[model samples]
Target: MYRIIGIIVTLLFIMSILLAALALLVSRISLNRHVWLAGFFAGILDFFYMPLKYFFYKFSDPRILDKWMVSLKNISNRNSFKKADRRMIIAPHCMRHMECPASSKRTGIQCVSCGKCIFSRLREDASKYGYDLYIVTGSSFVKHVIKEKSYDAALLIACDYELNKVMMGLKGKRLITYGVPMLNDGCFNTEVEYEKVIETLELFSN
Candidate 1:
């Protein structure tokens, strides 16, 4: 039985690798059908993603991976997000100003729109687009916020690593999700392409 289990695991690992390969090679890969399969074996792919990220960074363009992820997510967006009753946008605390005065709560950070950082603009746009924006400290809060609220779709902004992990968590839940990778990754003062964020928000807007 142990041997049989091992073989099954190995086959699943190879399948996930193949899926990742298709995402990288084919721009129009239909990811919604495979998301559940990928989620089932996400642990295997998650294990390999770190080294693969570095490999792409060193040998090829990292944008290839980012674009593929975005493309796959867009498929989900088109199918479910467009019809969502409630939408949320989860931003990261790392994007705040150095002396941000945002207060923490059970759900997440409450951005007061202090006009000290990019979040000020994001908060305004989020309000205009009718998205509930939450600034979170970590990935776990994302899960918490989603569970506590009735959101049908979410837009997340984070580093590639966190974005992938969050998407994995959302797999099989039937909730639509989109991610915007931060321009820089760190514990503080991270940045993202605000224009891209605006564009994505507009896509979901009527």
Candidate 2:
């Protein structure tokens, strides 16, 4: 398990660095002059990157990917999604922000497992629902998962700023998103809330 996880992490790291470099290159070449065009191009990159990265994910687990992909397709095509039950919560564990302040200005790194924040609670909810909940980063990766697997929907907890970016990338997916606070002035503890997440899902579930 450790070896598999290690390999996955290493591959993901490489992919992130390469993609970040490409984005930086785009910024440098345009010199940030064509702001609107650069933004559009970035969106294109995100949408296109979804399928490409999904290939890697599927290769990691062919059977799981194959079954989930078909399920996801049906969910995406649904009009009401009333039959959906299981869902995954995508929250930023400690990767979304640089520092904290409200709870003590402790960055996500300070999470001490007191089980008070959104992390533990949401994880519990996910387990309760039999959902594969993960506190992960990367809207790109989320998009990949959406494309490759069938989930009832996602409860994505991201900062307001990244919310737009993530929405842009995930525009057509069938997720019911709940935008939460990030950065300073938020709980400042990097903790997310299960009740709030449930509230978001309830909006579409009923």
Candidate 3:
């Protein structure tokens, strides 16, 4: 019985490794093409994320894993997000100017349109596209933002790691998410391609 159990455990471990490898491959492919069974693969990646992150940490940049996962999730969530009627944009505070005059609140930073950063134009475009923009200082504030309002979908803008983190965090909350990764990663002075944000907004406009 002990020998039999050992064999079964070994087989299961091998199977998990194989599935994780396949999921990683598909996530990479998702960057350039549409992938079938993307949700399934994404689930496998999520399940094995810690182990994968460790592997990447030893041999490569773990941020690449986050980037690939975000791409795969975007493909999986695109149609559902497009169908959502009440959508909101959750942008990171890092994208703001070094001297941003916005006031931070429990929900997020309130953009005053001081014209010192992209938020001024982004705020206008978000209004024009019918998305309520919330510039958050961190992921913890998302709970407050959600509590203060109701939304069927969330459009996220942040670093790849934060995008994937929020996307995973919002899973099973009945809110579909789509992420637009920032141009770079940092606590301050980060940026995103304004055109990409506009493109995503138009793509899912109702």
Q: Which candidate is the best by TM-score?
A: 3
Ordered list by lDDT, greatest first: 3, 1, 2
TM-score of 1: 0.73
Model 1, span 6-82: residue lDDT tens: 99999998987787665454433433344433332333444466776787899987655555555555554565677
* Alpha-carbon RMSD to native, per candidate: 5.2, 16.0, 0.7
Residues 1-206 of candidate 3: C-alpha lDDT, one tens digit per residue: 99999999999999999999999999999999999999999999999999999999999999999999999999999999999988899999989899988788899999999999999999999999888999999999998888778899999999999999998888899999999999999999899999999899999987
lDDT accuracy of residue 81 in candidate 1: 77
Regions of model 1 farther than 4 Å from truth: 1-20, 27-67
Q: What is the C-alpha local distance difference test score of candidate 1?
A: 0.76
State in Å the error of residue 124, model 2. Answer: 0.8
2 or 3, greater by lDDT? 3
Candidate 3 regions exceeding 4 Å error are none
**What C-alpha lDDT do the candidate models reach, one value each?**
0.76, 0.48, 0.94
List clashing residue pairs in candidate 1: none
